[model samples]
Structures are given as structure tokens and as C-alpha cells.
Target: MEEQEIYLLITRYLQKETTTEENEILADWITDSVDNEQTFEEIKLTWQHTEQIKLEESTIALARLKNRINHQQDNKAKTKKLVPFKWNAVAASVAIIGLFLVGLFYLLKPNDSVPTTYSVLKTRAGEIKTITLIDGTKVSVGPKSVLRYPSVFNNSERNVSLDGEAYFEVSKNPHKPFKVNTGDLTVNVLGTHFNVNASRNQILTTVSLLEGKVEVNLNSDKDDAYVLKPGQELTFNRANQRVFQRNLDSLNTLGWMTRTLNLSNDKLSDAAVKIENMYGVKLIFADQPTADTRIYAQFNGDSIEDVLTIICASGNLEYKKQGNKIYLNAK
Candidate 1:
């Protein structure tokens, strides 16, 4: 299709007024070549970013085109005969829209030259992995977790999406703020050490700051933002869209980084959850009382059997281990 025809069809498509035939024509044109598809995407992106064209802007644009036409008239006397007056009017309209589109393209085009491409890193059950991001940030991913990030940091910001638990020691870069998006909540920081637990099985997503400051922005309500200092923690309950902050022990918050499990008078049921997550085991309680029993202990790099043995001995309970499952019962 001619450039003018393509722009017209693009305008119709943007306005959602394209006919079936026009749609097919545009689709075929876009599918014919990669360049065509990229052009179409650029046009679409520009159109979405630009505000609705105002009548005053269009009129001013047309007036500017008229002055250009008058200037061309001065040169017309020295050259061949100009196109017909009707053709000039039609050309003027197209020029106005074209100028508006060109201005929008330049005004709204992304400043960064880097193309955005994403890479996903995931860990299965009973697995833990560490990754160094392009920006030199170190991330320790816990079991059953996935992190999706851009292959390269953009000029504007560094962003990554996470699901499950991870410890991040972000490299210091104040100019490019780093952001972690966990669907329901977004954590923003410059250079900071933080632990985020956003496991799908958990009711609340927790963000614990180890060093530096970070801002937690709620997805449910964009206006809600909480700033967390070092040793402070923020919890976001997605169900009720409630967010609260509290002081947290830095050791407890950062323990998972070193495979250190600490339970300070934690309920048996809560500890069970932590054990299950840490060791990727299924803990079944024989009765509600056994599950509700409380215990206090700390385990550093302990095997699953040792941890369970300690828990059972402290609670006067018996635990039978089978493969990846453990059964806890009152002895």
C-alpha cells in the first residue's frame, strides 16, 4: 500500500472504525515483512502514548501548511505548473495529519535505545539458586519461585517481577531506581538489601528491609505507599488489600539467605509451614493439638531429620519420616 494509504488505514484502526476489508489489508501488509510489523508497532505505540488530537492543534497545523504552500507558490513561478487546486486541498489535509503524527512520534518515542527483552529464572521444589543481574544485583531465589526480569536494565529504571521468596542485595545505583513487582505489591529501592516472601501459598506478602530504605507501593491502591527503613518490615494482605508495617529482627529476616531457620517461640503450625517451605517437605499432623503445639529453636544448615527430631523432642511428639513427607503425632 502507498504511505498515505497506510497512514489512513492506521488512523482508522486506531479509531476502531476499520472495516473488515481494511483490517485484512492492514494485517496482510504487516505480515508481509518484519519492517512493516515494526512500523505498525511503532505507530501503535505512538498513537497510544499521544493524547487525543485537538481541533485547535489541527487548525494550527493546517495554517502552518498554508504558509508552506504560499512559500511553494513563490517557487512555482520558476518551475513547472503546480498540481490542481483540488489536489492541493487533499494534499494539505494529509500533510496536516502527517505532521501531527510525526510530532507525536518524536514527542512520545522512548528515550532509551535498548530493546526490552525479558528472561525468566525459576526454581522448582526443594531447589535454591542464585543469580547475578545485568546491573550486578545479586538475587538468591528460594524454592518454588519465579523471577522475570529484563535482560538489560533500561535507561529509565530497573524492574523485575517476582513470585515466591527471594533475597536481594541490590547494587548501588541511585540514578536508576530498582523496582520489584510482586503483582499485588511493588517494592522500589535504589541500593538496598531486602528479603521478599510472596509465596503463592502464603496469605500475606512480606517485604523486609535489611539495609537502606525502600518504598512499597500497593497495586490495589496506587495512592498507598509505605517507606520501610532498615530492620523494618511491610506486610501486604492481598485478599483485603490491607498493608501494615512493623519492626522485624534483622537476623530472622535475613536467616533464610544463609539457610538458617530460626523459630522463636513460634507456634507448631507456623513452624510446620516454615519447615515445609525450607525443606520442601509435606508435614501432616495426626491431630489439631499436635499441630498447634508451640516450640522455640534455631537450626543452621540442619538436615530435615535433625530439625524434625528437635521439634518432636521439644513438643513430646513423635514424627515418622517417609521420603519427602513427615507425619507428626503425639507420643
Candidate 2:
């Protein structure tokens, strides 16, 4: 392609005018020589500026056209476009370039003009997940739990919201306090590891600290804070917005966060309810009083049968299953 034709191609590109073949020819010539590249840039930039000027001119033309149409309608005998508009229409070819640059910069800018970003990670019954947060905190969410945070954190603060249970290996950035919003309670830490259990209508949203100090607020909106030391657990009462710190075995409390399950001789009915809710399944008692039967066990990625088989053998309980549902009856 001649260098002269390349100049003509410049106008066409600004108006989005070139066919594929023409554009390829233009691209080839521009990339072929250093002089051609500079010449192409100058031409393109000129076209952009000229295109903006033409756009403004066209907008004015359009406004004038509309006014003339209205005038003709108001005076029926007055003809619209009595003098045909002598628009060369090449103004847009001159004006749109600068606008394109401004728009490009706006899209590529830092923070990208988006104020806040939020994410929710939830697991249902029998399902679990491992997730990483914006602040570089790594989490392992238990079945029937959810963890949420922004896709990106701002320089001012780092925040997350959660429902259910999760083990957090929080990333350390002293200036930005990592905060977790779990319904009525808020867990804050400078840089630490912890586990939290918060769910809807639950009496207590328990928080177990593994490392570092975590400020647990029963009423997140209130000034009151309960600072939990390593190896201490705080049960934030969702009902009354009270925090209770207890001396507990960190291993047992943090058990569910791992691949194991630990239940300290909890009631059979309570355990059943927990299992059903965690897995989103139904546990029907074939015998009404049987559900209240007492049981004790630890689960570590055990199959439903492994847990049931032991429970049945130990408690003299009989069980039956049909489809995804299970029934328990007294033996």
C-alpha cells in the first residue's frame, strides 16, 4: 500500500469505515516500518481530534434539523429544509479521538471507580470448601456454612461477612484490621487465626481463637468488645448479644474446621438436627421418642453408614432408609 493511501485509510478508520481487507492493508503498512508507525500514530491522533470536532458539528446540525422540522410543522406552509443542508458529514471523522483516550484511561484507572465489592461462599450439607479472601486470608468452610468478603480490599479497611462456620488463617497487615461480620456479632483481629460458628436463629455464634488476639463484639454496633486470647473460645449469644469466654480444648473446638468431626456426647436429637441442617436432609423418627435417645461419637469424614452403624450397635437402635431420607426407630 502506498504511504499516501495510508493517509486516506486513516479517515476511514476513525469513522469505523474500513473493511477487513482495507484494515489489514493499513495494519501491514503501519507495522512494516518505524516511520510508518509514527506517521500512523500522528494520523490516527489527528483523526481522533478531528472526529470530535465533527461530532459536535453533527450534534449542532441535528439540533438545527429538529428545530427546522418543528418550525415547519408550526407553519404548515413553511417547507422544512427549504435550503438543503449542505453537510459534508466529515466532522465526526475529526472529533472522537480525544474522547476515546479519556474513556480508555477511565476504564484502566486504579480502583476502577467501583466503591465496594462483596462475595459469599456457602456450603450445603455433606459439602465443604476451601477459599481464599482478598486480604490473603485462607479459609476452610465446613458443611452448611458460608463466608463472604470483597473481591478486593481498600487501603482503608478490610472486611468480610460470614454465616455458618469457617477456619480462618488471616493474613497480617497491621494498618488494616481484618473484620468479620457474622450477623449480630463482629470478630476483629490485627493478624491472627480463628474459627467462628454463626448461623441464623442459633443461640450462640461461637468464635474459637487459635492464634493472635481477636476482639469479639456480641453487639457489633456497640462499643463493648471481648478480646479473646489464644486457646480461648467465645460464644457470642445471638439472642441477647452477650459474649461468653470459656476455657475449652482448642483441638476439639477447632475439630470441625478440619477434615474431622467432633461431638462431645451431644444428645442424639441434637446431633440429628445438626446433621439434617448441615446436609439439608430430613431425618424422620419412625418412633417419636427414639429421636430423643442419647448418643456419643466423633466423626472424621465418616460415611453416613459408619456413623449410623455404630450408633445402632451401641444404642440398640434400628434405622431404615429410602431414597435420600432416613428413619430411626427403637430396636
Best-matching candidate per TM-score: 1
Best-matching candidate per lDDT: 1
Candidate 1 lowest-lDDT run of ten: 100-109
Q: Which runs of model 1 end up more than 4 angstroms from their true locations?
A: 1-115
lDDT of 1 by residue, 79-148 (tens): 5443333434446676435533433433332582425678899987667898766555779998889999
Give each model a TM-score. Answer: 0.64, 0.63
Question: lDDT tens digits, residues 120-152, model 2?
Answer: 888887677887553346788877888877755
Candidate 1's C-alpha lDDT?
Answer: 0.75
In order, what lDDT does every prediction score? 0.75, 0.65
Worst 10 residues of 2 by lDDT: 99-108
